[model samples]
Target: MKKAIGQILSGNMLSKALGLLREILMAKFFGTGDINGAYRIAQTGTLVPINFMTSDSLNSAFIPLYKKYLAEDEQRAAVFKYCMFLFFSVVSILIFSILYFQSEYWVKLMAPGISESAREMSVSLLKVMAVCCPFYLCSGLVNYISMAHGDYKPMSMRASAQNVGMVLGVVAAFYSGNYLYLAWGFTGSYVFFSFWVVFRAFKGEILNFPIRLETKEVKLVMSNFWITLRPLLILPLILQGNITLERALASLISIDVVSALDYARFITDTVVFILSVPIAFAGLSEWASQTPEQVREKIIKIYYWLALLVINMSFFIFLSARDIVIFLFMRGEFNEQSVMATTHIIQGMSIGLWAQVVGYIFIKALSAHLNNRKVLVVMVFSLLSNAIVNVLTYKIWGAFGLGIGNAIYGIVMFLVSAWYLKIARSLYPVIIQISAGIVIYFCVYRFIGGYFNESTSAMLRLLVNGMVFFLFAFLWAMLFPFYRQGVIKVMTRKRLR
Candidate 1:
């Protein structure tokens, strides 16, 4: 399990780096312009449905069932594999056709705040990018099949190929000044990746192309998949609706607002998603069928560490939001206005970043438990909180308010998870350490090395400021008896060795 986590973390780090690079290039080339806004809208429209299905309980149900069949009988596994492949292909094509035909209306509905030219451009881009659905879903199917075979490598690069695609798109748009290539490059990614994974799947013998699709196992597996999946159906709608609501509200303010919101969101989610994915994967077994009481202590430990990660990272990032934004994105087409806008959004997001992590983990655990009704109730309350806050605050704060709305949504979900899991009582011991860490970190950075904010090199300032806070925090922690003894024991062992 540790080895699996390490492998996943390594792949996630690479994919995240590539994903970050993709966003940086996009920001450099496009900034918060009309075309960038259009691209952002087009991406939102294209991906919401993809995530609705791909990231839903269907995929969650896929691998375990496949593993079950493979363990019991390889032929049965193959038959079920072909059956799912066929089913997903039909659904993908149907989705693509619908999006392709209705691109204009979708674009208009997605972002009414943008100009006519931008909207028209996005309609074109949406039509082109809609072709990605079939390839994307099929690629995921192959990737899941490979995963069930104990091959984690393919899933690691799941979105890496898409990031590479968008990187190419940014470069093409930069050189040719034709935004259409951006859409084509986006679509082209799924095309290339789908074929690549299919090849890998065949090579790995996880999937066989020339196979009998009809078998007795196919019917049984299909029925079981539905049975396993039926109750979780409302999940995708609520999750997708949260994203759609935020973007739509951002657009109501201005297209620039939505673009900044999108870019800033990518920055926050990169780290959050990377850390949380592993926790979710780890907790899957505990959640599968166990009662909450059975896993309370174990989960509390995990949650405590996650809390530490969230608090420390959030304070550091929130205070240093400007420097990070400048270092990463304040280049090329991304100028002063864009930086200011994006920094504000990042700061607001950092405030509740931990809530997103907690909420994400809670969602995964809940899904594994197969309680979709509870999931729906939790998610819908979150959505309502997000909508009310967004409508109330967006006009006043613009993109920052939208970011706050995101934070509220996350907080609602986390609150519900706390109630359902009933782990708040167990968290009391760590609360002091967490609070002390927050205070020390803020004072050390804000009063001392935070002066480095005026330094010319953004990177240097960030490093120095971060070191100053963490160093002080470590020393402060050593003053505590428990932490001091832990350090002393480690030193004593080192000397003995």
Candidate 2:
């Protein structure tokens, strides 16, 4: 499991770095301009449905079922795979066709505040990007197959390929200063990497071409998918709606506001991906296989460490949001005003970043237990919270209100998870630590930041403050026996291996 985690973390780190680099290039070239906003809206519109169909919606049902078949019979597993591949492929094609034809309306619906030129441009980009939807579906199934076989390398390589394509695309767009070029680059990524992963899947025997679908196992697998789809897989669909709501609300404010919200939320997601996603990936299969009691124990331990991660990372992000934004994005067209707008959004988002990341773990655990109804209920409430808060606040706060809405949703979702899991007793200590960490981190950053001259570079100030906070936090963690034991245990296990 540690080895699997290491692989996921390394891959995620590289992928995120490249993704951030691509975003930086986009910001440098486009800033919060009309084209940039258009590009953002187009991409979001293209991806929300694709992401829903390809990611959690498929994987939540696919993984456990695939694992089950693989455990019982490889032949059965292969048959199940073929059927699903056929089903989603047809769905993907149908959806992409719809999006391709209705791109104009979708773009207008997503970003009504944009000018006619930007709206038309977004429609063109959305149509081009819609072609990638089927590829995404294929890649998702192949990746899940790799996971079931305990071969994570293919997924990592696929991610790397996609990021590379995106980076190159952004670079090309940077030179051309054309949103059309950027759209092509985005489409070209799915075109290239999907084939590459398909090749890998074939080579690894994770998938076979000319797949046979008419097998007895097909009915069983389809039934399982139906059952899983109704409850567990529906979560991502609702979450996607929440995302669309946020973007739509932001668009009503201004196109620039939409881009700013994306930037801020992207940064928050990057942090969450780095800290929580790999762990969740590594632990999920084990969690699924465990008895309820064992799962509960695992949840406690995961929650404890996750709390530590969330609190400390949120503190760092809250304190250093401006510097981070300035250092990474304050270049070329991405000017001071863009930085200021993004910084405010980040600050508001930092408030609930912890809840969001932790809630992800809770969702995964619940899914593993086949307790998807609870997850769905929480998500429904979260979406409602997000929509109401966004509507109420956006009129007054603009993009910042969107951020605030996300935070509110995150908080509500986390509370719901805690209530359902009945973790209040174990959660008390973590809450106390979070409070202490927040106060301590704030004081340390302020004290260190106070010494810096006004002319000091943002990078230097960020580094100095970050280093000081890290040292203090390290010492604090060392003083705690549980934290110390965790560190020692991991190190000892690695050394022994």
Candidate 3:
């Protein structure tokens, strides 16, 4: 699992580096206005349901069951994959057809404040992009299959391809003054990446696309899928709802508001992609296969490690929010207002980074056990609380308030899951260690930040400050016996494996 995580994290790093470039190009070409805002709404709106069907719904249910089947009989597992592919493919086709024909309705609903001209443009672009949904569904299944086998390289490579395609599309849009190029670019990326994934699966002998409706494995898979569907669907609905609500609220403020939120989220997601997502992906199967005692032990170790990583990242980002935003986005149409807007939002978002990390750890642990009912209850409570907080605070804090509300949701989720799972006591020690580390780092940052000249390049200043901070953090972690022992244990365990 550690090896898989290392590979996935490396790929994630490359993908995020490219993703940053993609966002930079977007800001340069489209600016943080109606054009970009409309595109953002249309893009997010179109993908939300598809994500629900693929990642949140299908993959969540499919992976554990598939792992169980694979353990029993390879042939039976192959048959199950075939049935799932057929089922998902047909559903994806239907979804795409409906979305393509109803593109205008979704666009209008998702971005009501956009100009008529921009809305029409977004609808057209959305329809074109809708062509890629079935392909995404297919590719997503392939990626999930690879994940079940502990190979995340394919998924990471596909994301890199998508980022590369978007960068090319943004360049085309820049030269041609045609935003449609961006949609086509993304479609091309999905189509190509899907083909590549299938080719890789074939080489690995993991491609089993034949339909075998008569097989008992088919009946078994279908039954399990339906059983897993209900509780699994809650997470996606809440996640999609959060995005829609955030965008809706931002639109009420201004198009720039939506763009600002998007920019800030991109920064926070970079941290999540690196530190949290890889572990969740790699550990799902591992946890599922573990004994109850082993799962408890694993969760404790994993949670503290994630807490350390996320806290360091959160503090670094919070301290360097302005420099990061200016260095990455203060160009072309992304002006002073855009920089200030994005910087504030990033700081707000950073406050929740630790909570997000902890929340994800709890989510994966629960899912591993297929304890979906308890997880569902926790998710529902978190979503309701989050919505109320967002409504009450958005007026005063704007996008930053949205971040705070989300952070609060993450905290609630982690605490609730910990208490329910009877793991709350295990967190007390790590909490103290993390708190002390944070205070020490903050003081050092205050003294260190004063030394950098204001006239220096933002990127240079950030790079230098990041180096200094990491050095201090490294020393702090190494000096602590608990952290030192944890690091050695991971290294020793990996070597033994």
Candidate 4:
């Protein structure tokens, strides 16, 4: 189990590193321009449905069901695959048809604050991106087949392929001298990558697309869909509340506000991908397999350490936002103003990193227990809170207001979910660790600011400050009785030669 955890973490880390490099290149080339905003909206529109159908539903439903089928009747696995394929094919066609026909209206609705040129560009990009819907739906089914077989290597490689496609699209944009060609490049990559996964699945004999669906298989699929719908019905309202509000409100801001928010969000998500994905993949399977007492013990043991890591990293990034943005992105059309705007948004978003970690973990833990209804309820309430705050504050605060609302929503969801989990005993230690980490970070930031000019490179300042803060926090944790015991156990476990 530990080895499996290590493999998952390693794959996640590798994928994140590749994604980080891709983002750096993208920021340097595009910044927060009309073109970039159009691309972002197009990509978001393309991915939203895929995320809903596959990630949101498949992870929670398909894996468990597949496992059950394998345990009870292994031969039924083929029937399950064919049923899922048929269902996904029908759904994807319907969704894609609507999106293709409604592209213009969606462009007007999603980013009405942008110029006519930007809106038209967005519509064109959305049309191109829509081509990937069927491909993604098929690929998603292949992902489940591979995962059910206990072979995550193919899934990891396929993920890398998707990133490769993004990199190729950016390269095409850089040299093609036309955005349409770049958009086509993006569309082609998704097609190729999705087909690649399908081919691999077929080669392994783990996937078979049936020409005719079985009645019993169809009923089973419908039952699973209904079970999934119990959560899906409320999920969009709960999950998209903040995002929908952000886009709508940003549309009311300055012309560039929407683009700026997207850029900042891309950066913030990069950080989240780094921290959250590995922890989730490593922890979820382990938690799922553990006894209740064992799970509780493990959660308590790791919660404070994870909290400390998030707080320290958020502080480091917040303090170094300006340099990081300027050094990595202040080139070509991405000028000084773009850097300043993006940096401000990054700093604002950093405030919520700890909350995000807690909320994400809670969601995963809840899902493991198949308590989707409770998760949906919490998400709905969080969405409502986000919508109210974003609508009320966005006019006064601009893009930063959107960031603040996101952070607040995360903290609220974490608190609410923690209550649902009945884990108050774990919260006190986490609160103390976070408080100490924040104090240490702020004190260091002030001292560094006194000696160093603001003109210093953001990345350099962040690196130095991060090292000092981490050292202080490490020493502090080593001295505290509870943390000291954890450190001693970890060291002893490693040193048992």
Give me the candidate number with maximum TM-score.
Answer: 2
In candidate 2, what are the lDDT values of residues 17-81, reduced to their tens digit? 88888888878888988888888899899888888876664676778777887798777788888
Q: In model 1, which regions exceed 4 Å deviation?
A: 69-77, 208-219, 282-295, 369-373, 440-450, 453-455, 476-497
Rate residue 197 of model 4 by lDDT: 83
Give lDDT: candidate 4, residue 119. 82
Better of 2 and 4 by TM-score: 2
Q: What is the C-alpha lDDT of each candidate?
A: 0.77, 0.79, 0.80, 0.70
Candidate 4's residue-wise lDDT over 355-465, tens digit each? Answer: 777677776676655667877777777778777878888878777777777777777777877777778667867677667767866886687664357777666676776
Count clashing residue pairs in model 1: 0
Query: Candidate 3 on 1-497: residue-level lDDT in tens?
Result: 88878878899999999999999988887778766776777678778778877754456578888888789877778877887788879988887987799888887777666678777878878887888998888999999899888778896787789899889988997799888888888888999999999989899877765444465667776787778767767777887787778777777666777788888888888877888777877878788878767877887877877777777878888888999988888888998878877887788777777877777767777778788877777777877777888878888988677777777777777788887667899887776777687798788767765557779999899888888777777777887787899789989999999
Q: What is the TM-score of each candidate against the true structure?
A: 0.90, 0.93, 0.91, 0.91
If ranked by lDDT, best first, what sequence of candidates would result?
3, 2, 1, 4
Instruction: Report the number of clashing residue pairs per model.
Output: 0, 0, 0, 1
Candidate 1, residue 23: the lDDT equals: 83
| Positional deviation of residue 489's Cα in model 2 after best superposition, in angstroms | 6.2
- Against the correct fold, how does model 4 do in TM-score? 0.91
Candidate 1 lDDT, 103-189, residue by residue in tens: 898887778778899888889889889989999899888877775666666777866778888888889988998999899888998
